[model samples]
Target chain A: MMRWTLKSLGTQIASTLASAGGVAGAFLFVLFLEAVFLGESKQIVAYIEHMEPDIWVMQHGVSNMHMASSFVWDWKLDAVVEMDGVEKVTSILYVNTMVRAGDRDWFTYVVGLVEGDKRAGPWAMKSGSASPGPGEIVIPALFAESSGAGLGSSVSVADKKFTVVGLSLGTFSMANSVAFVSFGDLVNILSAGGTVSYGLVDLEPGSDAAAMARRIEAEVEKVSALPHPEFVRNDFNMAMRMGVDVVAFMRVIGSALAVAIIAFTALVQVSRRRRELAIAKALGVTNRSIYFSVVLQTVLITTAGYAVALALALGVAPMISLFVPEVTLLVSTGSLLRMGAVALVVAVIAAMVPAYMVNQVDPLTAFQG
Target chain B: MASSKLIRADGVSKHFGTGHTQVRAVDGVSLKIGYGELVLIMGPSGSGKTTLLSMLGGLLRPTQGRIEVAGTEITVMKEAELPDVRARLVGFVFQSFNLMEALTVEENILFPAQLIPGGIAAARPRARELIERLNLRERRDSLPKTLSGGEKQRVAIARALINEPPLILADEPTGNLDSRTGQEVMMILFDITRDENRSVVLVTHDPRVEEIADRILWLEDGKLRDRKSEDHSWVRDPVCGMRIDEWTAVHTWERSDSKYVFCSARCKERFVEAPDQYVNA
Candidate 1:
């Protein structure tokens, strides 16, 4: 049996590895792109970790806080700050803006962090100072690199210029670079009578986020507060649901291509071994054995292909990160096993018809040619 | 033929297709091949030589006859038991040298052993011995595609012999080879039959094959026409054992008032040594 398996291994290498490598290469690239999208979302969540907010208050009917409108009176923050178990309450005003540095402009998001609120400040600083005063701003390192701007340089946003006091590391949202400034500066730019887009509430230790969220929703309904956490979660869920649509489309396309490739592989393998299969039958090898041999070959080939694809993903992960920062191609052993199981199923599905053809081959035809 | 014959075919018939379109490939053929005999079935194309061989080897179930191989009635055996009978009692050599291209020569030779009941360990030494005897040890590691026509046939022969089957069935075994290589292959096959006390039933369109057979069963139009024993003066063409009629043969030599006929000069030269051995009293 070992000898048979070893011979089968050699047959797989000689016949299927080249084509499998090509297919695996294409699959690796697509998987890498998907990993980048997931990694980007993860990085966005990591960037805002210091806020430590138990509940986020956003506008009603808003789909995503980053891409929707949310405005509440400035007085709402004071009301939230007085709520029991609420350690602190701060408002964040964020909007998309085009920032100009050295005669070139790049699109970015301008986020307003309240002064003296350490919970909402830039999490990591690569250079300069994180303490941006009124009229000063913190820009992401990617923006600094692309714009060729440095410390003390001035960046113009909404026809107003601000000094770049600090450089923040790895702060990006959906591929857009971000800039941070004081809440007062943001209020002045928006010209909205000091109304804020969102209220960030930091809860006391041991407070349940879900419980606080329900209380906050009730309070907001009584006072008609604009931004609510339940609504925010609903909006987050909706936007993520859209992201799921895109993921599903990607999966469909990947699966279709994988099926075609595997089918072609099975076809070629069966055609090549038709004579051998006939001879086997002539020599009293059972139809079941012939079927198994072809199926086994398909399984072995697809498994090797999937393994090569995983290795390619791991090999190119760091290189991909170099081009698209914060994007890491991560495949756990569980993921590998899942992919292998999927490939095996795909292989069997692909090999079924061809294996039947092998079983039907007339042993007497072996005498003809 | 005795009831204990190694192979017995009683009223065997094979038909292809359905109803009006049916073609009788083998029609009502009954014959017996005894133990330790070299029998040749000779016929033209479409004469059911191969069809008969298929039934005799248990590769095909005759549509209407009781066939027995090694005392086991194959017509009554289930499909699952066919492989067991084939592995235990019958070995087949195909005309086209159907060696697995992916496997090495040695691997192809040992394929039958791998398919048998026991592990390949029992067949390894025999395979090695056959390989060395056939002068294929040097090319054992080479793939079938790389070997010459003769070497490929030798590999197929060794594969057929690996299981030590009692009955050897070969269908036009030398049809694809040149005369010289075919002679070498025939010698090896005949040597195997003589040394192992095995029975050989070879089907061929080539008349030369009849010379080496102890008996020749002539098939024509899906039926057996004659079973004739040839005189020893007919030199068995080493390429294929076709018995040439000494009176009308083109290649012939006289010895002791009897003329020995050959299909080719090569066989005549091969028979020159110990001519008395091939001559009838």
Candidate 2:
């Protein structure tokens, strides 16, 4: 009969720490990527989606907001507003330009909207003003911090100097920072008078968005209409097609490495304790009991690693703001649960190899002198 | 006086391998060890003493014949059932004092008891008693590696007797101990036989244990030989009137019933001359 205890606690802790560090570190990387992806995806369509618009009327061939430019005469806004199931219409503009703050120049995504329009604006403003007035701009916190431009600081865009009157957090499209500008100022800056990028249409409640988009397409000549959600998905797919899928592939690799680390640790622990297992089996202990003990040991070690990783994720997640201050690293309950489920599954899978090894250990080895 | 037999082996044999490479580790052997008796099987290395003991304890299955341990034909039992038989009826002690390095002295002793029904609660008090009786109370919390050789053997003995099984099998239990410590351990085993009236069977080549054994069974070349030889001297040759060294004798006569070793070829020839006259006489 053999009594089992933590005779090798040091070894167990070392193994657990190694695997936990790997899993938690990979999870943190995945978290940062997720934050960036989410932040960018939201920012790309944030102006359109937050407008509560059911349908969008863009140039006939324009596919997304970032890479494509669609222009309609200012009179189209009034025309789309008169369509059936149409509640209201707003004019919006998109422009990509370089903004100079001191010696640093940043490629920026600019959104121009009508003043006092609640349908489209900086949704979350961490500090400073939300809506920019004429000759004033609201920049995302990430751009302002990175370029050392704060509230009241001036930046030159398109050879025109504008004052930074406000800051918005988590408002960026991929690597391009966002700045809200007045539509009147945008027309003066771009010199494209009486023309807008797209016309946003809000549908009455209970209006079928797909049906309304089709009706709007019929009524508006040389323009295509789409549901706001469908347009965002199209935009996201376009981003994915343009190499954002690499992040997904890296996530898969990170998960596999986490499982591998746990499995390798369990395997080594079982090999080192084979003799102890043999002794336990020889002492009238059933094979199943010995197998269960090995499984339990693996799960305990893996769980310890998971706990350490979880604590690390909590501690390091918030610090991602230091790097990309516009994108807040989200550690939601759903994401934590997902990580835990993955850790448990990896732990179980890792225990299986060692459990099989325990079954093969001969009890007679204990008798060998 | 006739006592009930605790272990009954009828023509049991264990063989390994097949064809020309086959090895008969335990040849056909039949014997009975009675209740409360202490029997020692003495043999040189590779004589199949441990294999026979293992078969009696249900650890290794016999290739031929049947073995009854406490009235159960354990040789015919299924693989899964053997552990239960061993846990309930047989206790084993090894030469290496195989105490678990991770467990404290008391926990090692209580391990077997915990496997039985109502064992968990009963184990604690029983372990405490044994620790006190073995004078191990002070060192009860220490791990195996920290204990001295004698202390380790004492803990092993306590563990073996923890379940209070009817039959105890010890394989060279004192092989690693010094002469004085060896005798002390042997004496303790002998005392166990007397105090509990438990049948104890030990396999050892240590001569110090002979005085404590009620009977000694001899084994050679995987076969059982004569029993209870007081002096390691002459074995009578069935062929001619002669005394020969059983250890060094080369000439031998093998019959269907028994084997006889002879000192000379002349004696073997004489036996072959008239088989019945010498063999049956």
Find the candidate with the highest DockQ and give its number: 1
Weakest ten-residue segment in model 2 chain B by summed lDDT? B240-249
Can you write out model 1's per-residue Cα lDDT over A319-364, one digit (the tens) per residue? 8678866344444454456566667777788778686677678877
Task: Write candidate 1's Cα lDDT for B1-281 as tens digits.
Answer: 43567888999999999999989988999998887788888765678889999888888888998998877898999987887788778888888888887788888888888777674778889989999999998998999889998999999999889999989999878777756687788877788778988889988644556567778887778999775444233445433366544432445677778656565544666678666555532
lDDT (Cα, tens digit) per residue for candidate 2, span B1-281: 33369999999999999999999999999999988999999776788988999889888889998999888889888988887888788888888888877678988898788678877577788788888878899899998989987799899989988888889999888766654576678888998899989989998756657778899898878899875455465577785455555654445778886878764444667777887998668
Q: Which stretches of candidate 2 lie over 4 Å from their true place?
A: A1-13, A16-76, A80-88, A95-108, A115-138, A144-174, A181-195, A198-248, A322-327, B1-4, B227-281
What is the lDDT for A246 in model 2?
67
Ten-residue segment with the worst summed lDDT in candidate 1 chain A? A221-230
lDDT for each candidate structure: 0.73, 0.76
